[model samples]
Target: MNDQAARLRRMIEDKHPRSDNKSNNIQENSKPEKLSANRGPRTIAITSGKGGVGKTNLTVNLAIALGNMGKRVIIIDADMGMANVDILLGTTSRINLMSLLESDVALEDVLLRGPYGVSYISGGSGMEHAMELTSTERDILFRKLAGCEEWADIILIDTGAGIGGNVLDFISAADEVLLITTPEPTALTDAYAVMKGYSSISDNPNLKLIVNRVIDEPEIREVVGTLSRTAERFLKISVECLGYIYDDQMMIKSVRQQVPVMAGYPESISSRCILSIAKGLLNGHQEKVKLGWRGFLKRIFRS
Candidate 1:
C-alpha cells in the first residue's frame, strides 16, 4: 500500500483495536442481530448537477425546518474542498472530519452545532482524502459514522455540486438523493445529466428534484414537467418533484446575514416553501426506502 493508504489503515486499526480471542468470543456471542429496516436515522444527500444553484441554502434551511418539527437532524457538509456550511451558519470549527480521520480526535469533538438545534460536521479539505480511502478504511470510517445514528433522526449530507467521484459516492450511498436546479437551461441540462448518470450506475436509485428560483406556479409546473418527462423517457428513471422555492429577496438577505431564511424569516415565501417540502417528506408523500447507515456504508465501500 502507498503512504496515504497505509496511514489510513493505521488510523482505523488504532481506533478499533482487535480484542483478545476470549473477549472476542464473548462479545460475538452476546451481540444481537442487526435490526430490521425503519429502525435507524434517515440519510438524505442534497446535491446538484452544477454549482450556484442554492443547494447548500436549501440543505441548511430544510434541516432547520425538520428540526423545528421536533426531528433530530444533523447536516454533514460533504462538499469537501469548497465547504461553506460553516460560513453560511456563521460558525467556525477548530476541527473537522479530516482532523478526526488523520488524528485521534473523536468524531463528536468535530461536530459543530448550528442554528435551530441542527448539528453539522464540516468536511473541510479532508474530502480529497476520502476519495483515496481503501475499502477497508471506508468500512472503518462508516462504522465510526454509525455512532451518529444514536443522536439524530435525520442525517442530511450537503454534497458538492457536479458528478465527480466523491459526489457520486455520497449520492449513491444515501437513502435519498435530492437534486436541486434552477430554471436556467444549463442547470436543467446538468440536472438531467446527473439523473442519467446516477440511473445508469444504481439500481432503483431514489431520486427527487427541487426546482429553485421559480417565478410562479406556472413556471414551476412547466419546469418540473419538462424535466420529469425527459428523465422518464430518456433515462427510464422516475424523478419525483419534491418541491420548489420561489425567488425571494428575503432569501438573499438571510444569506448575507449568515442566518438561514427558515430561522430569520419564517414567514417569508421561501421559508414557507422549505417548510412545505419538509412536511411532505414527513407525511410520506415521497416513497419510503430505509437503507439506514449500514446499508449506506455497504454501498460506499462497494463503490
Candidate 2:
C-alpha cells in the first residue's frame, strides 16, 4: 500500500477505534484483513439526485482506495446512456454488460480492468436495455450479474443521477445506497426528492449520504445533518452520513488526465479524504453479513 493508504488505516484506528476482536483485526502495522470467501460481496449503489456533484469521480477514486486496503473492488457503470467509467479510466470497451443479455457471452469478456486491480463493467447502454430482456434472457443476465460476486469483495454500482425508474431500481436493489450531493440548494433539494421516491418504494431502505466538494467541516455538517434530519422528520426515513470530501484542485487535474486521484495524486488532501471514507466504510460493516450479488439481483428483478 502507498503512504496515503497506510495513513488512512492509521487515521481510521484513531478516529473509529474498533473493538479488540479477531474479526475486527485491523492493526496499524498489520495488513488489512483479506475479504472473507464464506460470504458474498457487499454491493453498494452509488447515486446522486442530480449530476455534476462529483458522483462518478468519487466512485472511481473510492474503489481504488478500498482496493488499496486489500479489498477486491468491482465497479458497474449503470449510467446507461451516459456511461463513462471506461473513459474515466482511460480505457475503451467494445463489449459491456449488455453483451450477456444479447447472447451467450461470458462476464469475463465484458469486464474492464482499471487502476489498482479494480475491474469495472461499463453499462454502455446495457443497463438501459437490461430490463427489456426476455424472461429467459433476463434470467440469464441476472445470473451473470449475480456471478459478479465471484470477482469482488465490494461491488460499487454507479447509477445515473436522477429519480427515474431505472436509477431507483438499482438503488433499491443494492445492499446499501450511497447518495452523493453537494452544498448547492438545488442539489440538496433533489437529494431529498430521490430519498422520497426511494422511501416510497422500499419499506426498509439503507440510504447513506456523502457530501462532495465541501469547503469546511461546518459546511459538511450542515449538508449531511439537514438531509438526515429532513429525511427522518418529513419522510420517516433514516440516512447515514458516510463521509464527506473537501474541495481540491487535484481532482480536476485527475479528471482531465483520465486518471483517478487515488493513484495519480495519492498524497493530495482529496485522496486522503477518500481513503478515510473507504476505511470507515469497511470497518463499520465488518460485522454485518452483506447479501452480495444474488441478493442484489433478487431485489433488482422483483422491483
Candidate 3:
C-alpha cells in the first residue's frame, strides 16, 4: 500500500507540475479545457437526508458494479468528518484527503485504490475545513479532479448524510445526485427535505432515488409515491426512482467481513437489485443534468 501511494504521488508530481504546494493544487486557468464531450466523467453523488440507510454500502457496491461493466470507476469518500468507505473495502489508507487541506499532502498522495480495480479518495474525519474552499481553492480543487476525468468513466461521491454545507456542496457540484433511502416515513420526509434544499439552491434539476432495504412492494410504492407527490406539490420537482435493494442478510455479512456485498455474494437478492440500478446509470437510461461547469458556476454564484 505504501509503495502504491508513493507511485501515485510520483505520477502526479511528475505529470502535474502546477501542483507545487505539495497538496496537489492545480492552477485553474492553466488546466487544459475539457477537449471533447466523448463520454466525460460522470460525477454521481450518493447522499441521504438521514444516516443509517446503507448509503456507503450502496456507493461502494455501485462503483464496483460499474467497474464490472468495463468502466473505469472512481469513488470519492466525500463524507468528510465520518467517512468509513475504506473500512467497507477492508483497506487502511496511508494518506487520506484531509492531509491535503490540513498539511501539504498532494491529492495524488491521498487516493487509495480499492477492489475491482477502483480508485478512491478518502474524505477522512475532520475534513469539514476543506469543504469551505475559497473561490480560488475551489477552482483549483475542481480542476485537479477534472484531470481525473480522463481516467474515469464515472466518479461516485459518497456524501455525508443530512443537508449540511459539505453535503450540499458535494451534491450540487455533482452531475447527478443519487438520493438513497429506505421505506421508512422519516426517510421519505428527509428525502423530501433534501430535494427541497436542492430546489431552493440550484436549478440543475437532476435527483435520482434508490429505495433500499425493501421487503414489500406495496410499502415501497407508498413511500416513493408520497415523496413524488410531496415534490410535485411543494417543490414542483420530480425524483427518478433508480431502483430498490431488498433486505438481504448477505449485505450484513459482507459488511462484517469488510467486503462489498456485490463482490462477496453476487447472487444475493440485494446484489441483483444493486446491479439493476448500476445498469440504468452506466447505460444512460435515466435523465441527466444538461448543465456544464459554467452553468454549475452560475448556479453556485447566483443570488
Better of 2 and 3 by lDDT: 2
- Tens-digit lDDT track of model 2 for 1-303: 333554565567557754443321113334223333446788899999988888788889989988878788889988885667776788767777777775546665566665556678888775566566666766877766765655578889999888875898888878888899999999999999999999988756888888899999999989988998999999998788888889999998988999889889999989998998898788876455556677777666542
* Regions of model 3 farther than 4 Å from truth: 1-39, 101-107, 125-127, 131-140, 284-303
The 0-to-1 C-alpha lDDT of every candidate, in the order given, reads 0.78, 0.78, 0.72
Decreasing lDDT order of the candidates: 2, 1, 3
Work out how many backbone clashes candidate 3 has: 0
Separately for all candidates shown, the number of backbone clashes (residues 3 or more apart, or on different chains) is 0, 0, 0
Give RMSD to native, each candidate: 8.7, 10.9, 7.4
Predicted candidate 3 versus true structure: per-residue lDDT over 176-261, tens digit per residue: 88899988878878878899888787656688888999898997787778888888899988777888899899999999999899
Q: Highest TM-score: which candidate?
A: 2
* CA-RMSD of model 2: 10.9
Which 10 residues in a row give candidate 2 its minimum summed lDDT?
Answer: 23-32
- Would you estimate the TM-scores of all the predictions? 0.83, 0.85, 0.79
Better of 2 and 3 by TM-score: 2
Residue pairs that clash (backbone atoms under 3 angstroms), model 1: none
